[model samples]
Every structure is written in C-alpha cells, then in structure tokens.
Target: MRILVRVLKLLVFIMLINHLIACSWYAVGINDLEREDTWVKANDLKGKGTVYAYTTALHWSITQFTPASMEVVPMNELERSFTIVVIVSAMVIFSSFISTITNAMTQLRNLNSERNAELVKLRCFFSDHKVSASLVARISSCIHQSNKLTGSRVHSEGVSILELLPVSLKCDLAEEVFAPTLCAHPFILTWSEYYSRESKRLFLAARSSSLGAKHELFNTGQVAESMYFLSSGAMVYVRGDTRPARVSPGQWLAEPAFWIKWKHVGHASSTGKNCELVSLHCETAIRILSQDASTISGARRYAKTFAAYFDKQFDQLSDVWADVEVLQAMVSEAFIKHEKELLRHSVASRVVKDTKMPGLLRRMTSRFSGVSMASRLSSEEGMSQDEQINLILHERVRKYGVDGQKRREILGTRSMGSDSSDEVLAPVVSPVFRNPERRQSIGRGRFARNGLNVVPGIASAFRIMTR
Candidate 1:
C-alpha cells in the first residue's frame, strides 16, 4: 500500500509538471506577439483556437516529459532553451521515479522471500520431527496470526511482545486497551462494580499468550490456577460425557478458580485457528482482591455457593454459556433441579393474560389433553370420531368448540398442574370383525388429520379388536 501511494504521488507530480510545461509553451509565443518565428506563430496558430495552441503545446509537453518515441524539434532560440530545461527536468524526474519504484519492488520481493523462507524452514523442521501435517498447518496459522497481532514476527524461543514494552508503558498500554472490559467482568463486578484505577490495573496486568490448535490449557481435575480470557479465536472445553463447548471471544475460562480454591472439572484446548488468551492467575486475583477485601462480600458469597455445588459439572463457564447470569442480582433467582418444579407450578398457576396463543405451557398441556380425550368426547356428542380427531390434530391453536368441554377442562387442568398422575388413554385398533375395506382405509393413514376421506371410528367404522 505504501509503495502504491508513492507511485501515485510520482504520477501526479509528472502530470502536474507536464501541465505547467504545456501552459508555458502556449504562453511563450503570446508573450512576443510580434515574433512570427515561435512554434505557435510559425504554425499559423496565433489566430487559431486555444484548442489548436494547447494541442500543439501538449504534443510537445507529453512527448518530452514522458520521453516518448517521437520527439518534437525546437524551431527557435527560446524554444531550444525551453527544450533543454524540459529535457533536464525530465531526466531527473523520470530517473527518480524509476529508482523509487525499483526500490519498492525490491523491498516487497525481499519481504516475501523472507516470510517464505521462514515458512519453508518451519514446515521442514516440523516434518523432520514427524509432526502431523494438520498440526503443522495450525502452527503456521499461529505464526501468521501472532505476526499480525503483534505487528512483528514472533520468535520460537518463547520471547513475548509484553517483554518488549517498558514496565510503565506496558501498564499504561494494558490500562488503555483492556480496562473497560476487565473492569466490568462479571467476577470482578462481583467483587465490586467500582474499583480504584490501581485495582483495575492489577487485573489488566494479566499475562497474554498465543497458542496453536489443540494446545491444551488445562487437564481434567487439574488444579485451577488461572482464569483465561479469550481475546481472539476460539477454544473448546470438554467435560465428561458431554459434547465439547466452544468458548468464544470476550468470554472467561476457569473463572471460579480465579476467585476461590477450585480444580478444573474438564479439559480445554485451542481450536483449529490461532488463539490469543489473557490469563489472570489465582495469585494475581488474590492480590487484586486483597486491596478491597471489605468490598468483596459478594465474591465471598459466590465462592461459598459455587463450593456447595462442587460436583456439578457444566459446559465451559463463559459469559455466553447457557447458565451465565448477566446481572449480579440474578444470582438470587438461581435454583437447583428440585427448585424447578415449584417454579414451573408458579408459572402454570399464573393466570395467562395474553390474548395471543395462550402461554406456551398452557397450549402444550391443552393440546395433550385434547388428544387424550378425543375419542371419548366424540361418543358423548354423537359426533363422528373423525371430527374429534381432526379438532385435536388441527394446528390452528386458537380457541375452538370442542376444546372447551369438561373432559378437556379436567385433562388440561391436570396437565397445567405439572402433575404426574394415574390417567391413561386408549390405543387405536381394528375391531374384532369389521369390513376389510374400512380396516385397510384406516391402516393407510386415512384417520390422520390430512385424510380427506375420513375413516369411521369405533362406533361406525370397524370391529376394533380389544380385550
């Protein structure tokens, strides 16, 4: 991009110089109106339109400045002097343009060659060690990403970018870059929403690291010594008997460990792409929290609650994880499996006031009850069984005629109560001795909601075999 800009500036310079030369060429003859020997006057262009004069001047300017194959001859002494000056300027300007462009191209080629050499050596070195091709590719990706993020090549000997910055500058840089995010971190906020600049700085002092795919951050049951922050890329956290969960950017890993004595319940590793992680060690967190021990009442309570459920293993405890609480106050509303039943009952008992399709649970329960009591309701109403079945299976969940019956009311209420009770429903079957055609028709799904020619129910249709 820099090279392109340099070349563009040169092109503009050349065009501007050509424009000045063209104007000067046109002006020379006009300055001496009495002279008939000037190029413009000699060409009988004095009375000619400005177009003709400019065309003639531009012809000379373009040819001389661009150093085209065809050259314009000087016809008079002033023209000769002007030609000499133009020729000298063209030589210097064109020479510089050529030199600048050459240097830029050389630099670009050398940079590419250097990068290619490094990659070739990397691949060769990895291949020599019999590393899998896939892992080598991920390592290459890490190098490219590290170079991009740090704005320089990262060496293999374990030197880090943070070490390059002066101590005070590093603190200021970290404060500027990570202060807003770390300050509002859920765990940090649990300690206290507001902290001194120094307290925040200590959190921001967390160390950063770059890793390749499958680089393990922790082993199962390992002592949780640090909490990880995914700055970029993703990590997969694997807990026993559950699918791996992806930990995305701006999410914390092993957070509870940073606050209290805990061990990693699962393992975590970097994904296919490179990852940049910032880890706050337990010691660092302790030191930071110590500064405001009196204010960390909430954190202390949180640790106690977490310890109470020490054996419970969830997915990676990220901010975006399924059970994350956005607001600190929401911790009070959290419940265990046994507590969920009471909550469901409360929601079920809460009168549904919305006009739209009744509350989700209400609709589900009502639907279940309608189906169970479908055949029974048909017998009482002297209506065909098909009609009741259709009503139950119909997708338009709006309030309808049969849906308000007492049998439906009883069953629907039973469902809404979240009760597991002794109510059982009938199963469909062909009667003991019925018409074969009707039996075949019902067997062909003719009793389904979409069936156009409805099959008869137990009363009119078939000899449904039952004990």
Candidate 2:
C-alpha cells in the first residue's frame, strides 16, 4: 500500500512539472511560429524576405543559432519543439504507469508468499499435534468458507488469506459436519429458536448422523464429546438397572453437561428404525456461548425450567405410589435425590443459589416439601460469604437431635414444633388434604400467595410425627 502511494506521488510530480513547462512555453512563445513571434524568429527583417532568410539560415547555420537581424521563423522548427515536449510528457506518464504496475505485482507476490507460509505453519501444527480427523475436517471447512467469501481459494486469485482467516475460523467447525443434515435434527431445531444467527450457524456446523441409523450418543462413564438431538424415531437411554427411559423424537439429551462438567451417567442408542440425530460438538457449543451473553442467560433459564419440571415430575411419580402415611417419606426421598442430582453440577449451585429467596423458598416447599440449608442460604445477595456460612451452621445445629432441646430452651420457643412422631420437619400439607380437589386448590393458592407460607395441617402432621 505504501509503495502504491509513493508511486502515485511521483506520477503527480511528473505531471505537475510537465504542466508547468507547457505553460511556460506557451507564455514565452518558445514554440510559437508566426511572423510576429519572438524567441526563435529573426527581428531585423520583415515579412516574406525575413521568413525565407530564417528558414535558409536554419538549414546552413553550423552553430545552430539564428542571426542577430532575424525577426521571423519557419513553421517546421516550431512544430519539432512541440513534438519533443509531447514525447517527453508521454514518456513520463508511461514510465510512471509501468512502475506502479510493477510495484503492485511485487506486493501481491509477497502477500501470496506470506499466506502460503501461514498455511504451512497451520499444516505443521496439525501434523505435529496429530489432530483428530474430526478437527482436520473442521479446519478444511473453515478454509472452504474463507474461499467462498473471497470468491477464490487461498492458493488461487483471491483476497489475502490472512484478512479472512478470523472470519473463516469463526464460521464454526460444526458447520462442515452438519451442513448436509442440519434441518433433519430435531434437537438442533428445538434449541434453534433460542440462539442468534451466529449460534444457529454453529449448530449448522455440528456433526450429523445418517438417517435411519442407530448410534450411541452417550456411553455410560465416558466424557461426552457431543450432545445429540433426535429429529426422528426414538432413543433408548438406560442408566444401570433402572427402567430404560425412552427419549422420543424432538427430544435431546445433554443436560448433564449443561449444568456441570461430568461424564455420561447413562447411554443412549438410537432405535435403528428411521432415526436421525443432530449432534453439536461440546467445544463448539462452549465457543458459541462465550461469544453471546444473551445465549448464556437463556441457557441458565432453560436449565432452571428443566429443574423445576423434573422436580414436579418426581413429585407426581411419588404420588402414584404413596398414601398419606408414606407421602412424607416419599417427599423426603425425592428431595434428597433431586438435591444430589442438582449439586453434582457445578452450575447447579450457581443457579440454585441465585434464585430469589422468596421464590426459592416457595419452590422448596412445593417441590421438596422440606427446607434445605443449601437452598435457603444459597444467595449471597446482601450478605457476606461468612454470614451465609454462619446461617447454615446455625440451622444445622437447630436441626441436630442433640441440640434441639437446648436450642428451643434458649430461644424460649418451640423450634421443632410440637410434633415428636417425625424427627425431620415434613412438608406443610394443606388442611384440606382429606378432600383431594380442595387440597389441590388450596395448594395452588398458597403457591401463588407465598412460597414459604406454612400449612396448619402440615405443621400438625409434623407435631404428630415428633410425638
């Protein structure tokens, strides 16, 4: 670029000099050839005789100089001087143009060489690292995308490869793998609405499975590389001897990694009958999330919604088998299991802790029917970390069997209530439990009113359990 600028400046200077010379010649009558013209004409004579003498003298003059008496000039000599000026101007323009082209060509050659060198370095890096085939495929995709944007390949006539390297790499490796089957995967489509165009592009780059094939999206105890979404057919997911959970079409399974980094807790196999899946590589997902803050927030919201759904589902499942007597037990077990699952994820603590106190308390009452220290003191909000810790410690002490009597005596109030039948505080059940519809109606009312409000019946039940 600098070279081009310098060439332009030289061209301008040459043109300026030519212009000045032409102007001076015009002003001084250097190329003028009339009988009245000065500079080259004879001055002592007049008319035709002087013109003939000037012309004859020019042909015979050995010194190439006019006589002192010359007052007129011939046309041929004036035309020759004008032609010489035109030739000089043309040569200046031609030379400047040629020089500019040569400099441009040289610079292009240098850029091409530099680009090749960078590509070679990338190749060496890939070879030295023994990169996986999948990664190589992604790199090739990035190169192809770069070429498309520039309308030419890196080695062919195109823009500088370096200039588009960032964009090409940013295009997402998943695009290459998923391009052919993007629309076929339901899982990608399901989350597609939550993402931006760039995020969608990342999804498009994901690896996709062939239609009507059975594949293991996750293997028990293995770190998951990608998350799979079923677009057609169903996936059978099994964890241990527990019943195999069938993941139907339009459902995806990658929640374990969403909240926390953990190995696959279960294995999923496509049912082999017209099943198609879209798989998003975890690395690509992470990259996309990092680039978009809104997406991160959206992801957290989704996770919370999922958690709530799971909790509610668990409660419903418990209700299927439990009577009033075992309801408390069932609820306790459910809470413990749910809490354990949530805490396994590093993100679980962050999410669970960030919920507003009133909302969190309400969710605890409705979902687990028990107050957990992790949920109650989770938010740091206005309190210091130490205060949170102290609050948790105090709660634990009050709940301890050995210290319960002493705590109640010191507080001069019944901390554990009047119940002795139950060792742990059971969820507060509505007074209308005897009537299913009324109980449900009251429960909904309480849910809407306050999450932490205690039910008189539940408190009475706790009193009975303690007794």
The RMSD of every model to the true structure, in order and in angstroms, is 22.7, 22.9
Superposed model 2: Cα runs more than 4 Å off: 1-195, 211-215, 272-274, 294-296, 300-467
Candidate 1, 75-176: lDDT as tens digits: 778888988898898888878878888998898788779989988998789879999879977777667655554432243225566577676776677666
* Residue 452 C-alpha lDDT in model 2: 34
TM-score of each: 0.44, 0.27
Q: Residue 421 deviation, candidate 1, in Å? A: 47
Q: Which one wins on lDDT? A: 1
